[model samples]
Target: MGTFKFSMKMLIRDYKKSLFYGLTLVFAVAVSFVFFNIINNNQLADQSIAVGGGTWQNVQTPFSSILSFLIICFCCFMIFFANNFFMTRKTTELAVMGMSGSGYINSTMYVLYQTFVLLALATPLGLLLGRLVIPCSNAYMYERLHISKDVNIIPQEAYIYSFLLVAIVLAMICVLTAGYLHRNDILVLLSQEKEMNFHGSSNKYKPLLYVAIYVFGIVMMFMNPHSPNAYIAPTLVGVIGVVGMIRYVLPDVIKHLKKGVFLTKRYRLISISNLSYSIQRSLLLFTLMTVSVTGMMAILAANQQNPREFVTSVIGYIVVVLLLVVSIVYKLIMEAVTRKTLFFNLWKIGYTRKELKKIVKQEVIMYYAILILIPLVYILFIAGRFIYYGDMTISFAVIFTSAYVIPVILSGFLTYFEYRNAVVKPIQGGK
Candidate 1:
């Protein structure tokens, strides 16, 4: 009990580290719960039975199945990713604890305690939110499909599925924590915060891997099987491409920016130099931004390709929008947190708050441009096909323009506000 209390206190002290991760779990759980209900609703089944399994039922079965599968895969990936981030943040603290004579068992127990504490808080909140939102989503779907069936807000099966999801997440957290702890010794953990020579050793092979993954994705998309399985190849391609870009391309791009004419400007020089030094973390933020843009672009492409699939297209748009918003907000918050000290130093070196804000704004715009441009080009290539087929319409033009423009504007405002609140305010307060 004492140990649990201590762990809770530690979590509170570093709440930023867990905030987004816990929220991510809650979001994932809620989404999965909604999806599970949609898949297993008794009312839906009864309707199907009454209609003797007509087109609606036939369509609903495969649609719901695909949705559920996607939701499950998303939840699993999110759980693993969130835990990895959480554990990475804790590496230095765990190392310190180990140096202070904490045993291996103690470290393991602490990780477990922290994981369960977060789960305990997030699971119920997620379930409740899911219950509240599912009805609205169902209503939207039914309206889009011109279905007269009443939407159930809470299904009994949702509770069961939600609990099962929690269990699975808990198990995954345990496994990931165990694996992370096993891999790094106290020395490695302690040194993680310091400069490491081996950090760029694998840079040479990264481009090869990146090219291979992109090629694989292109091949998969071209193969284009008629079944749902066809999506797997393209999806894998996207995931691998995003990961490889983050791991290799983004950092390399930043490192090379140091040689440009922009280096003549002091703020640009400083920001680029700082970014180059912390390329790994910078790449993570860029990766999130790239993924969000890519996702939104992909969703827009699909919607444009099949305008008649109203419900599916709407759902895809909603999911991608949520993903983009969350990823951008998360990246901003992380940037603020991680760069707090750097901002402070810049202030000490005679930079005003407004100047610092401009620097951040510039950096964000640069990142956004790079991250968004590639996806935009690819999406344009896809849209060109629709144009060739005479499928480009004013409605799609409107939707595409709004989707693309609104988010970019929102991202700029978000970055500015985040810099002011998280970075500038904190530094000013410290003074």
Candidate 2:
């Protein structure tokens, strides 16, 4: 009991250090919840309109079902990751506890205590944040078009349940992570090093190969975007391309950026290294951003005077962009913070500016490529398909999505590059 209480107190005392991570998890989960909400509302709206009755209850039930489904997944992932972080942080402490005559049960209990402390702190905040999203989203949609909505604001009771569920999942993750500590030897715990051994191929031509694969995927996706059938093959291609780039292409990209090759253009080598280490993380981040921007562009592409255009076409674009932007920004900000922590660690390892610059360049290029590819492929395959099978009116939407890809890619790359420089320079110089 004493050890458990002490662990909780220590967590609270060190809360500032953990706060950013907690908030980031909360934010990601919150965004996931919101996206789920959007999807729920849309499905509900379609059902109600189709059946021609049942007021908002039809929408409400579906909304709750989908929201609950999404929240469960989000909570699990967030809690598991948080538990892993806690275990890593407390490895030495747990080792000491075990050595000091504490049984495995005691250490596990201590871990549970810490997990509950975090859950208690995070839950209410997450619920409040989730509830606040409703009015803001409603206003944005309303402002996008003056269309009145039958949308219900997120109820207070919903927030309470959300908090409870999130808390329970986090607690369970804590128990799991703590159990791992008990199962490991004391020596193993004490000697553990926090090394990230991400696997990848060492081939020199990997980046270009991945770039080609991604291009091919995009072309495939765009080849027949309008047919639901067309999207399947392209979607599979996209998933493969993204995975290939992350696992194989990214590491080689960093290498080429550091040691320039004849095939690489003048600034291309530098750019690759600048952005590639966090390639997978950055790719996911940019995909979210691209989706968001695409949605916004879609809205602008539509004719506003027509009610149907405003509801279907414009709203569709808005939703895509909103989903993308929300997902991307949430990822980028969290990643940006983590990247700073990484730089601080790198500085401890005696890394130089040249080395850091190379890493940043690799990351930037990988991210830009990934972000650009999604929109381009979607416009090509999906747009063409829509023209052939869905609707000719969507042609303009495709054109705008195509036109908008370059700026979005460039802007995302530049912003992260600058952010990386700002966060790293001070730590590098001990400023």
Candidate 3:
């Protein structure tokens, strides 16, 4: 009883951390519920619509097995990655408790209970959200797809399969956690974050290789955007390139920016110092976000000419991007909280509160610049295509840009406030 109680207490104490990563599980299960619902429903899957004015007809909309599979695969990875991230922090604390005479058994139990809490939090909410989302566009879906049948019945498999996915993720987390706790290497495992010496990778040829892959993937995606294998494959490749470039090429770019005349401002250098690490950690996350939004953007561009399909694409864009925004907001909040120590150290070094505020603002802007601008450029390029081909109006380009930017702007606001509360004000209060 005492052991379980202690575990529960630890979880509650760090509930913010739990909640931050819980967004991942919620999204994971939600995507599962959604994709499974679509996949299991024959009418929704087979419905056909028209495309290309008075030309080749018999076109269909975006929902397909390949897209579903890609989404499911991506969600699975998100769950696994989130699990590892949570346990990496949690187990280290558990090891400390063990050192304080709490025993290894208690440590193990905490891992179990933590996973249970995640399962409990993610399953029902994800399913409920997913169930709700299916009907959001359904009324128009039949009209858009030109189908007579309602196809409005929610699939039972969405609930069953969503829970099943959550279960599998929980199981994997436990197995992985068990292996780590057994080895007892918690404290020494990931001290790289503590160490600040980052000698940018010496390999010059490899970064070019990543850029080449990035260009190739982007080009391939535009060339054959309709083919499922082509779209999903290039996206996978592009993500690798984006992640690799962020991990490898970006550091080198930052190093040059710091030395070059472009970043001559002294204050900006402080932002650079902080950005160097945060961006590195954000590699896969921002890249994955790019894929999610851009995938929907591709649909938007392809369907820009059709009114119904365009509406469908916009709704799809909102759903996919907003799901990611939830994760991004949680992430920004957590970063502010976690980097409190770094901010305090800056405060101790004779940096005033105003300067600290500037640093926070600079970091937030720079983060958005990197996170939003890359994808925005790509999205704009996508929007530009329809304009060039005469399938879309300039206003649609504005609409496309607006859809992606609005949530990002809102996110930037949230990031600023969280940083103030978690880092800036606390420092002012002499903590």
Candidate 4:
């Protein structure tokens, strides 16, 4: 009970973070409910476009399965990742509680309590949103897919399955929390802050090989629609190359930038120095987002040919973008919490709030640039051919731009605001 009170206080004090988590949880619940419901819709179960129908039903059938599987994996992974961050970030707080005579049991209870509360609030709201979204989706299907499948009653199995999924995620967090608290000593928790090396990656040979793969992959994209051996498309091969570029080539490139130009400017010096190392942490998530956005674009471009694919892809893209925003926001929020000391040191060393803010913005832009640039070149090459062939319009180029660009800018803005709240204003107040 005492731990519960402390947890409640933490939740209320950090209501902004709670709210962000709540929004994400709500989305997970809502999307799960909607997806399970749609995937099991009785009317749409037996029909296939192979028989003589529209293209959408076929795409929807397989794509939703793929999409839902991805969603489950995505949500589960985020929950697990966030939980890990939660435990690590709260290490110091837990250490303090230990000093106050709170045992591991109490500390574990405290974290679990807060997580449970957030999940409790999110589950019901998400269900409501799921219920509301059905009608909207039905309307879309009628207009775009040329079919009507009214969701008069939400399937009981869907409700049960969605509820079970969240419960499982919640249970997994509880177990992981208990395990972390039980396994680590106070020293281990305290030492975590010193773990990340600020000097950044320092390898050279990796970039040469990865750059070759990057070039080879791009060339293959133009040459082969499908690989002869594995039957994988060159686009996928190109995505793999992009991953190598980030995981390898980027750090080496920055080492040069540091020597030539970026080191000359204070803000650029800080941003560039940090970015290469930061790329290591961000590479996987950024790759996933890039793939999702790229896949979303491919599906959307197909909409010109298959109207069914358009509307459904639009719905899926909206969800993808929303998830992308929340996940990045979560990353930024977690970084701010962990890097408070680094920012505070910068303040004492001679950086002002204004300058620190600029540095933060620069870092955000560099991240966005790395994320978009490779994907942009590939998209433009394919889209140019499509447009010339009269398969796609110029208007779609505008849409593709907005789709990839807007949400990133939005996440950047949110990250900046959160940084000030988490790191800057507190320092200013202390001063």
Q: What are the Cα lDDT values of the candidates?
A: 0.65, 0.55, 0.70, 0.71
RMSD of each: 4.7, 6.9, 5.3, 4.1
Ranking by TM-score: 4, 3, 1, 2
The residue-level lDDT of candidate 4 at 256 comes to: 84
Please state the error at residue 294 of candidate 3 in Å.
3.1
Scanning candidate 2 in windows of ten residues, the lowest lDDT window is: 294-303
Candidate that scores best on lDDT: 4
298: Cα error in model 1, Å: 6.0
Candidate 2 lDDT over 1-431, as tens digits, reads: 68977687767777743564476556645654554454444422434353576555544443234433543454455446545655656667778888998888788877777766666666666656756775666556545545466445654444554555565676677667666875788888776533333454667676677677767866765455343344556555555565666667757656654565624453454345334544554554444344334333323333344332343333344334433443443344334554566666666776666665555555555565666665565555555555565454565755566545645565566556665665566573543
Worst 10 residues of 1 by lDDT: 304-313
User: On residues 132-207, what C-alpha lDDT tens digit does candidate 4 reach at each position?
Assistant: 9977775665556556556466668779988899989988988899999899888887777446655545676777
Query: Number of the top candidate by TM-score?
Result: 4
Output the better candidate (1/4) by lDDT.
4
lDDT of 3 by residue, 208-279 (tens): 888888788778757874432345666667777888788778777777888885476756877876777777
What are the runs in model 1 whose C-alpha is more than 4 Å off? 42-50, 53-61, 191-256, 274-313, 344-354, 397-401, 420-431
| TM-score for each predicted model, relative to the true structure | 0.79, 0.61, 0.81, 0.84
Query: Candidate 3 regions off by >4 Å?
Result: 45-63, 101-106, 146-152, 180-184, 189-199, 204-241, 260-264, 303-316, 390-397, 428-431
Score candidate 2 by lDDT.
0.55
Give the runs in model 2 whose Cα sits over 4 Å from its true position: 28-79, 82-103, 136-164, 179-216, 222-225, 253-276, 280-431
Candidate 4 Cα errors over 4 Å, as ranges:
46-61, 98-106, 148-153, 193-196, 199-202, 226-232, 302-309, 337-341, 385-391, 420-424, 427-431
